[model samples]
Target chain A: MKELIQLIASFVGAIGFSLIFGLHGKQILLAGIGGACTWGVCLLTDFLGCSLPLAIFFAAVFGSFYSECLAKILRVPKTVFLFSVLISLIPGSNLYLAMRYAIEVNRELAMANAIETLTVALAISLGIIVMLVTSQIQARIKSRGNRN
Target chain B: MSLTSVREKDRMADAAGVVRLALDVGEQILLSGGEVGRVEDTVLRICTSYGAVRTDVFAITSLVFVTAVWENGEIVTQSRRIKEVGKCMRRLEELNSLSRRICTERPTLAEAEKAFSEIMKRSESSWVKVLIGSLLAATAYTAFFGGDLKDCLVAPFVAAVIFGSQFLTKKIGGNKFFSQALCSFLATAAASFAVAMHLGSSVDHIMIGCIMILIPGISVTHAVENLIIGDTIAGLISLSEALVIALALAGGFALSQSLFGGLLI
Candidate 1:
């Protein structure tokens, strides 16, 4: 039940950003689905007792892959959908906590939160980069075959 | 003048026109927050098809340099210094489609220019729609982040107030740094107010929703993308911008927490 609500909320959040970012027509709805899918993956991984960064990494990978395929199928730039959906996975709260702890002069707690933020950020970005490289390689192989 | 000579002159002029057109499209894409390599590729494709003998494109975060040499030895170059960087997915999509069509349709210089102008002027969403969308998104985040029913209900009200103020700040053209700090402080304070009113169990969730507007996800993602594509300069610029914005956001939240610390959390 909790997972279901989170999915809807993720969809709403994604649609909200998609609209603000000036995504037009049916692309808004598609981006919303991408956002919800990312949340669902994140939730499942968390449920399985995976660490925060690892779960976020897998979730980001899934979201980017989903967005890439949808963009191809819909004939639009993949970033249009990926940008909106990726919001759900961003470590906004963790960033806030790290900064707050630092302001209070609690160096130890601040460092821990800061490290977590860095790890999650790297995991998310690297996950997307991996998907991008794989897709480019696949495209190159197909184009070469056509040339031959 | 001989008719044949005049015709040859027209062909050279046509080549120059196409090179200029390619630069315009590339500048538009770059300023609209596209990755560096994508801008380079689009310009290269357009200029080559228009019969440029040689082409070079160099792009950074705020500037684009494009030069082309025609078969007749006419060299055309453009340097555009972009004034602002904005994220407009609709415009990006439109420009992408325009470049793709230019490749396939092979439009003449005049026709291509006309099409480009029209695409750039694609209509903006009304303010009413933007406000509603933002408000709804805020409410959804409140719920998604584990806020209960009362927080969900109050989230839109706070969002409306925040965006309402944002509209004024945008029109006034204030400095982005101070304005962002102001907005974060205001949003978090409102979340604290909600806790005082017994609206929800969580104050931090509301702040997280409010801070969504300040998150640097786009810049960070684009920076990594540029780096992966071997455009180190553009990537570094984007990373710096992201870092600066993040610093401002954190500063605002920390200050606000000190003021409202005793009230909640």
Candidate 2:
């Protein structure tokens, strides 16, 4: 039940961010669905006993792939979908906790939180890079085939 | 001889006009949160489509430089310095479409300028929508982060405070870093006050939710992506700016937390 509620919350969160970013019409709905799927993937991986960073990495991979495909279909820039879909995966909460811990003068806890935050951030970046490189290679191959 | 010179002058003016138009479009894309590569690509496309024999564009996060050569070997070079950046996906989409149209249709300079202004005029989001977006994002994120019902209920009001402060900061033309710090401070203080009054369950959860509204998640992600794609200079600039904003946010929250530590949590 908790997981289901979290999933719905992720959907609402993405829709809200899409509106904030001035996206309208069908784009907003697509962003919300994308955000929900990203979070669901993360939760599923976590449930399967993957580490937190690994879970987040898998979720980001799926999210970026979704954005790339949708951007091609809709004839829009990929950032439009990418920003809203990946909002839920950002390490905002952990960053905040790290700051709070530092302020409270707990060096150990602060360092741990900060490191966790950085690791998760790196995981997300690598995941997105993987998809981006793949897409670029695919485009190059198609162009070369057409040329031949 | 006079007639030939007059035609030459007209051609020179036309070449300059095309370069200017291309630069304007590229600048708009950068200001509307597009990547550096997109700005460069759009500028080059617009210039070539308008009969420029060769075009070169160099774009960073804060500036765009373009030089285009005409058939007669006249070179027109222009640049724009971008001071402000914003996130408006709608504007980015509209500008993308406009550039595509410009490339294919090769519209008159006057016609292209008119279309560009129309898009700018149409993309200003209404205040009601902004308020609702802030409210929903704050509340939903609170719940997503495991906040209870009371904490979620208090988030929208705190979110409103952050939005109002943000609007006022922009209106006064304050520094971007100052604006971010102010918003984070207000959000933290407001959330703590609400929880102190027994309106919310967890200060941590509420603070996290409100802070999400102020995080530079998009910028960080874009910065890393740019680095990976070999836009090293642009990526470095964006990354540093994101770091500064994150520092401001964290500093403001910490200050507020210290101030309210005695009252709660």
Q: Best TM-score goes to which candidate?
A: 2
- TM-score, candidate 2, is 0.95
Please list the residue runs of candidate 1 whose C-alpha ends up more than 4 Å from where it truly belongs after superposition.
Answer: B1-11, B14-16, B199-201, B260-265
lDDT of 1 by residue, B138-213 (tens): 8888787777888787788768767876787788887877766777777777777778778755667776676666
- State the lDDT of candidate 2 residue by residue for B182-211, as single tens digits: 899988899888988999988899988888
* Candidate 1 chain A, poorest ten consecutive residues by summed lDDT: A90-99
The positional error of residue A5 in candidate 1, measured at the CA in angstroms, is 2.7
Chain B TM-score, one value per candidate, order as shown: 0.87, 0.93
Comparing only chain A of model 1 with the true chain A, what is the TM-score? Answer: 0.92
| Structure candidate 1, residue pairs in collision | none
- Please give the CA lDDT of all the candidate structures: 0.80, 0.89
Cα displacement (Å) at residue B212, model 1: 1.2
How accurate locally is residue B207 in candidate 1, as Cα lDDT from 0 to 100?
67
Residue-level lDDT of model 2, residues A1-148, one tens digit each, is: 8899889999999999988888889999999999999999999999999999999999999999999999999999888888889899998788888888888899999999888877887778888899989998999999999999
- Superposition error at A74 for model 2 (Å): 1.3
